[model samples]
Target: MFTRKLGKTKIEVSEIGFGAWAIGGDAWGPVDDGQSLRAMEAAVELGVNFIDTADVYGDGRSEQLVAKLIEGRRNELVVSTKGGLMGHHRDPNGEPVYGRPAKVIEAFENSLKRLGTDYIDVYFCHLWWDKQEETEAFIEAFKQLKRDGKVRAVGVSTENFDYIKHFNREGGLDAVQLDYSVLNRSVESEVLPYLEQHGIGAVVRGPLRMGILTGKFHEGTTFGEGDIRRNWPKETWFADSLAKVETLKGLVNEERTLSQAALRFVLNHPAISVAIPGAKTAEQAAQNVSASARPLLSDEDLSIIARVK
Candidate 1:
């Protein structure tokens, strides 16, 4: 596993970190809980020390499972989870809720209890709330946790490239997570340059394009009912995204798996410190970890990818 210093924070993590959201099976697809646990165990066995999760994932079920998964071996792993979008799927609709000052602290404590750890290696603001006051509240809340020695670093996960640039330029965060994938290169136009200049490292999520880039689904297969892909109408993002993947596949033949190519492509970005891709099975986990072992593509292949409409 290759490790890099994440900006100026002096923290090191494997280039291929295990993204833990798949264990939730809420936003993604149907996942067997046992297989997911095995995947987590496989990541550790394979020498991946960093794990990323969110409080809303499966509504905290994910965190508790992680707690159970890494119980005594906490020191060997870097557990990073996100907070700030509260309320409840537990309440009524699948609406965006929030955490008050006290609730925010309580949420972090509860997440620790669930992960069975004393401190979180990294914590992020999941998405963004409407109010700056909420951000301030979170700043205050996490500041307390940091002062109390509960969190090692702070990051923000957002799709807003401008905001990522703004955050890094302002200089309070240790890291930032964003959607940076073969399909999502907008981050490179601005966000990545700013991060590099400001000395902030990026955690690239959705590198698989939510599995569309994995060479799994063909034109015929349809997503399950609960699958978030269902929410993205087939006529819109799915069709366009699938078409793009096919174009990319032509550039990468049987010489390499598109999955491998996609993984290598994202990590090759100079600004990326780590790429977190979710795996539902142990085999998939191993494949993801081994992707970094593959040699990078030539400049022409990347340009070919860039020209695909």
Candidate 2:
């Protein structure tokens, strides 16, 4: 796995990080703890040093599992977890609660206990509450976390690119995590350029479009109970995405799988520091890490994937 510096921080993370969302066993459907551990172990064995999770994911289950895997080997990995969002375990979505220093500290403390670590590599804001004053207060609290040695660096995972641009202007964040992939190129128009210019590391989530780009789902495919994909906007969106995936399959052959091609397409962008694709099993973890071995997509390949409507 290739490594890159995480913005201005001294930490260097693997280009292919392990995303622990699925292991939480909440919105992604049923999962085995043993399998989750094995998958994390497989990722580590394959040189994956970065793992991203959140306090709200499975209501701390994900963080606990990640802590179990990296317990004694903390120095070997860089763990990035988020806070500031809280809610019931049964609900996949969490309520945004930021600004209050006490609440922020409490959330960080809880995450620390679950992660079994004294300091987090990168503690993200999780989501912006859309209130400028509250957001500023949240950033202040994050700085305090760094000053207290509870966090090494601070980041924000938000869809509000304009807010991110303003945050960057104020020198508030070291990294930004956003949804970006072959099927989702909305960020390319502005967000990518802004992050690149400001020197903030960008972590690409949903790089496979929640498995739609993996070619594992087709029309009429069904997800098990509790799978979040089942709640997606509309049926037409899925059908349209599947059609685009078909066009993308022509770009894949014997040497590469659709998932690998999809991941590589995201990494091909210079602004992306790493791409986090969730893996539920050991085999999936190994496959995700191996995607970094393939050469970057050519200009023509990128054009083909981008032009697909």
Candidate 3:
């Protein structure tokens, strides 16, 4: 797999990393534990060193599964996990719970226990906070975690660049995880450029737009009951995304699947550090890693993509 520096942390990570959300199960329909392990092992064998997960993912099932993946290979992998939405401890109103430093530390400790690790490679706040003061408080809490040798890097997983500004107010932020795909270019206007300017790494999630860009879904596609995308509006957002995916398929050819082509399109930008596409099985994981070996998207292909929206 191709490698890239995770911006300010200077940590080398596979350009195509594994996103562990789906493997956590429940949220993405039924998932086989054996398949999940094989998927992780397959990706690791292919040199996938970066994996992103969240504590809220299956209520810690994801991190526990990842703990298995890194058991004997901790030094070889870069793991990024998130917290802040677990609600283990909350205010009476349950508002701004993570704004409290103690709660932040509590969430971190729980994540560490679940991951079976003494220190996390990258830890991100899993939700956004509109309140600037609360956001700054969370940043300070993360900075304290770094100071305590509990996490190597600190960031927030959010699409709000304004929230990101607060996270990086003191210039201690190391990275940010956000959704960016051929179908979701909203980050290009602000989030990507800010991360590039401020030297914060960008870990892109949803690079496949929840499997739409894989050309596996169509207007007739319907998500399973437990899958998160099951509730997406079919006639509106869903139809529009599939329509755009059809346009994106023009870049696909004999050399790569549409999934690989979509991944390659995301990696085409210099601003992006890594793309974490979710995989539920070994075949999917191998397919994601294969994108790193495919040729880069050409200027002509990009020109065609520009008109997709």
Candidate 4:
């Protein structure tokens, strides 16, 4: 496995990180503690040094399990979890009330207590507050946490192009977890180049495009209600994302899966610091980590990748 620096910070992570949202086991679907621990163990054994989690995920279940999973192995991983997105209190309309700083800090502290660790390796603003003052407050709160040794450094996770650059200039985040993939090239237009210029690491979240890139889902494939796949509407580019899968199918030999190809595509770019695709089982974790050492596609294959739907 290959490791790289996370932005200009001293933190170094495996190119493939363990994305722990699923370990929280709610929006993605129902998962038991036993299965969750196995998934975490697989990632660590395979040299995946970065783990991404959030406070609002399952309202602290994910963080606590992560704590137990990493209890003695803390020195080997770059554990990054986020705050913001108030937990379990949806409005009457069933929308999350995000960006309550005082409450958000309370959430962070709760995560710390649950993880049973004194400090988190990486903490991020889960999302922007949509107001300058609020965004400023988010950054300020994270910065204070860093000073108090509650977090190593802070970053932002979002897909908003305009907001990423604006926040970079104004809020001064150490990193930003932006969405990017061969299918999602919009970031290359400006956001990625911006991160490179500013020395802000970009931790890509959906390199697999919700497993659609695995080229295994057929037209009739359907996820159950509790599955995260159900959370994404059919109208989403990813839900009905078979177009890119078919395109990628044309690029690789039949034996190579879309999962490997998609990951390789993201790592092909030097600007991409790490790709944190989620894993629900040990097999999935092994499949993802293998991409780091795999041969990159030929230029011709890459040209085909660029042409993917």
Best by lDDT: 3
How displaced is residue 203 in candidate 1, in Å? 0.7
Model 2: how far residue 6 lies from native, Å: 1.1
Q: Give the number of colliding residue pairs in candidate 4.
A: 0
Top-scoring candidate (TM-score): 3
Which digits, one per residue and each the tens of the lDDT, describe model 1 over residues 112-223? 8888788998988775533554555566776788789899888788867655544444467788888888887877777788788877878988999878889787767777
Ranking by lDDT: 3, 2, 1, 4
The per-residue C-alpha lDDT of model 2 at residue 126 equals 73
For 1-309, candidate 4 gives per-residue lDDT tens digits of: 899888888888899998888878787878888887888788789889899988877888889889988898787778889876543345467644433456456767878898888788888877644555456667667767877887877888886876776666664677889778877888887778878887888899989876778877776677787786764446566544676677678756654666887898888777788999988888888888988877788888787876763
Ranking by TM-score: 3, 2, 1, 4
**Each prediction's whole-model lDDT (CA):** 0.79, 0.84, 0.87, 0.78
TM-score of each: 0.91, 0.93, 0.95, 0.90
Q: Report lDDT (Cα) of residue 200, candidate 1.
A: 81
RMSD of 1: 3.0
- What candidate 1 gets wrong by more than 4 Å, as runs, is 87-100, 165-170, 231-233, 251-255
Per-prediction RMSD in angstroms?
A: 3.0, 3.2, 1.8, 3.2
**Regions more than 4 Å wrong, model 2:** 87-97, 232-234
Q: Model 2 clash pairs? A: none
Please say which candidate is ahead in TM-score: 3 or 4.
3
Model 3 CA lDDT for position 246: 77
1 or 2, which is superior by lDDT? Answer: 2
Residues 1-309, candidate 2: write the lDDT tens digits. 899888767889999999999999998999999999999999999999999999888999999999999899998899999886541121233433554666677888899999999989988887644666456756788889989988888888876887787666668688999999888888898888888887888988899888888798866688878999875536787888888988898778667888999898888888888889999999999988999997778777777786684
